[model samples]
Target: MGGTNDAADGTYALRAVDPLIGELLAGLPALLLVGPRAVGKTTTAHRFARSELRLDYPPTAQAVAVDPDAVLRELDEPVLIDEWQVAPAVLGAVKRAVDQAPHPGRFLVTGSVRGDLDSPTWPGTGRLVRVNMYGLTVAELLGRAPREPFLDRVAAQGVEHLPTPLERPDLRGYVELALRSGFPEAALELPADLRERWLDSYLDQLLTRDLAMIGGQRDPDRVRRYLEALALHTAGVVEHQAVFRAADLSRATADAYDHLLRNLLVAEAVPAWHSSRLKRLVRTPKRYLIEPALVASVLRLDTNSILQDALLLGRLLDTFVMAQLRAELPLCRSRPRLFHLRQADGRREIDLIAELSGRRTVAIEVKAGAPGTGDARHLAWLRDELGDEFVGGVILHTGQLAYSLGDRLTAAPISTLWA
Candidate 1:
């Protein structure tokens, strides 16, 4: 395993997913690590790779493009193919090689853009197991091992068992952390001005070069406007019409752009929770950029700007919490599904829900201020509705301590996520 100080050079970090990747590679013929650009996919792959074939290099790509099988045959075992999407035919060669041997740890492939989205027939249906990677979570940055999903733990063991955090960040501090982002360079190395410029360049490349490589042809300016609009609505149920008008995009173009962003793994949608036992529930998915830094960069927000606006701070906090939870999902033993809950009449809502096995759930609410009993009202209501299936509820706030609000519900500091 990589050491905890892996990010000293601002290129790699010991990710929570690293152990899982190692375990998977021992039995699987090929493993594909997929995430946004500059999220340390290549650096992680290098840890276990004995030899490498960088498909992004022109000569390597051209040679593989001509006869992928022959080129692949020449590499040593456990080869790393960086940016394998540059030569799509190499996937076919990999499929054939694995078919002949069916051995473990043959290849490690990394991709910034998903190649299957544009392929007519995916060559890696069974041969390659694709793992979802994300930016650095707080626990990862703190050099902690991968966390067992806190929500799942609460569901099984009650909220009274919540631990106290050693470090507490005030509201302004949390805002600054959100803006710092999870990208290794932006979060751990770059200064304020340089971080902003780095994030801006990332967006520019995504809008121009990355999109074109994925067969998307749209005006970069228009795409930027659309992205800014989404950033404004991050962590909320999107109002498509309002976003379209704000970006001056037609409905069709807006839909296409949305699909394009999701395909690139830059955005995500958390589906609404619904059940046959419940009626009049809202089903619209809540949308969020994969990381808070992307939203802050696109909207050009600073610490003072977010701190002064309560509504904006709340949304960004939700985004931040969601990112942490998503990063921990792979480490959970239960592997619970995540969702948001709302009523059609807007009478009750929950910021996030983790549905464990057997349909049981742990409901969560996010509050920007120090939490009080009033903050868990919606959680209480959901607890009453679901009874045993609703194991517990929690209100995550910027406070310094954890305490019970009511039966089966508690208010805990958001820092507990990393604790």
Candidate 2:
């Protein structure tokens, strides 16, 4: 994590944009990096290691185990082992290595899926630091342009001082991202249709291969239907009963499917933020698809229809804004906890709650068009309810301007949220 890892020299290096890099660089004696499929957990680990032993790859499992003393014995530094979850048994080996020589930044472990050990396993609690990695942020994708500094400027000058001018991503970029999805390699290499094919194949593999080993349900098709249903219901509060009806699944089956989605890191539920002693705050959490483009594609909601359709447009904007906030979380040295604010009278609702460090919070409303008083009505209500604890309220919309509605509200452009 400190010096550098030369093991990355010969590997295919995509632009290293993971904001978690700095945290992962400061590895404990043992650590685990977990994420959904194709989030670049393995490559990032290898790049951070001084040397690496890829246990999940061919031949190395035998090489590392049979000659553990030979493989890591002479090595006096951190060595990353990719996809370590595939061989959970080797964790005990790594644990013993740590016991013998407990050096910080010694073992960097990466895993895509989570599972249980058949036998009693070593608990490397304080010895390991856990981190989550995800797809490229818009900041990372913008390269070295003025757009690259959008969020940085907002952070420095405060939302009120943020510049109102910036060029936005055109329809082409939006279409490409929607069709291609966010698996780094597939996104970078393949054509749109081909990338869609790859995404479909990846989904199939997760369902047929990875999910089966989760050991609960024998049938994965049900899981597939539940996922599709969840995707369609993106950016809304989670209701298992509604999902049961939509997917034609039993209540128990729906619950199990939801658990599997979480276990697989395929979906996320954002809990409501109602710590107010006020008796009227809504406590039910909202659910969002982890990736915006995936939800758009699953719902076949490409193009400006997302801007024109009321319900679909709202969900799309909400999900995309959530993605932007998530991209900024690691950069701010915090975990992004998503939330929604609602009242019992159905009179007020804020779409996003960005909880930052020191309990400083920002309430954001997602909109499809220009920012207006109406767009920020709910945001203003939330600020009134939460008081000075509110960092500021923002209305994220499709417009190119970053104008302020008032002293407390800024209409932020979605493309510039992380510009």
Candidate 3:
């Protein structure tokens, strides 16, 4: 992360070194990089391979679609196949090639969408090791390191090593950071108007092209409306019927749309943390957009509106924290799974939860304003209820200090996500 250039231009930010990528490339025959569009999958894959075939190009797509084997036969070198989803047959070719002649690092496949059931490729299973990615994290964008991965830290010890800071992100500072686009092509460096236009175009492409590719006689206009409605519901637990009604989509159609978004990693379903230890834990998972800026783009909310709208700000602050934890979880040593916890009656709730092996779980409560002792009440309750299974709890706020609230409960600033 110290270097200004990542393999070349400064546009490529130094994403945290993912040991999974290294290990997969060394032992696996194919590595599939899956995520939403413009997530830097192609850019990251380019770093390791000399030979490449861009299936996104019309000519290449046609070639692979027509005869995937010939395309693979032509690539004798370790090859990078960009937008492999465009020609699902290429996946089959890669699988066949791997089986015919076993070799590590023979193929690097990048996809903007999830695997197509109709694709000619077999499940690959042991053949294709998948690595999920997202838009550049705040740490990567700033070219800095996170102060401490609170998720892993809390999982290891119960608030024993909570970082202390005299200053952190205040209210205004939090909004400013969230407003910055996580997409590298149109990040904070760009003017506000330009970034907005870029985001608009990105949505246009998704609705116009990618959505249709998922099947069904999908109407882009309807899908656009559905996505807009979905944006309004982001960062909260939603009933499928409510979502379908808002989007004017049938239940079956909504299921297909949900699958597509989930495949793209655009809509993260934060599963509700269930524990037999508790009396009653909600089973509904909260819906979250991949990045906070996407919320602004979809809802057409400007910076001024975002700042003035308290309700929107609160939901987005929660979504942004989810984005950060999701990005960091894979990089953490514990590799915990992120979840949400709430009572059916809404008596208690934790905005974010990270669960590791052996019932060890770290709970987080996101507050857009300064957090006080009361903010830690839910965390304290969870700790007491779960006992040793509860790794610890934290109140992540827009405050300026990191301090302990009580036993196994601490208050830390949101900015600590990317120190």
**Position 173, candidate 3: lDDT:** 70
**What TM-score, to 2 decimals, does candidate 3 have?**
0.91
Q: Tens-digit lDDT track for model 1 on 1-419?
A: 01112445545556888888899889888998888887778888888898999988899999999999999898887999988889998999999999999899999998888846445578887888988778888887777756666766776688878877788898888887788878876766778888888888888988998888875578889889999988888889866788878899999999888888887788888999997777898988898999898888898888888888888899999999999898778767766889999999998889998988888888888998778888788999888889889888889999888888999898888999888
Off by over 4 Å in 2: 1-27, 62-76, 116-122, 144-157, 170-179, 297-308, 334-336
TM-score of 2: 0.85
Show model 3 residue runs off by greater than 4 Å.
1-11, 17-19, 117-121, 145-150, 165-167
**What range of 10 consecutive residues in model 2 has the weakest lDDT sum?**
1-10
Model 1: per-residue Cα lDDT at residue 275: 78
Query: Where is the poorest 10-residue window by lDDT in model 3?
Result: 1-10
Q: Which pairs clash inside model 1?
A: none
Ranking by TM-score: 1, 3, 2
- Whichever of 1 and 3 has more TM-score, that candidate is 1
lDDT of each: 0.84, 0.65, 0.76
Give the per-residue lDDT digits (tens) of candidate 3, residues 280-370: 7789888888888888899989767887988888888887877777766656777788888899889998888888877688888888767
- Give per-residue CA lDDT, model 2, range 1-419, as digits (tens): 01111123453433333435545555457777766778667666766678877666668777766656567666546777676665555676677787886766788777766665222454455555666666655544544311332333433355676565466654344434444455665655567666666666777777787787574555877877888788878888756678778988999888887877777777888887776454576776687778776776556556665656677666766776676566455445443465787777767777877666556667777766676777777777666767866667777666777888876778866766655
lDDT of model number 3: 0.76
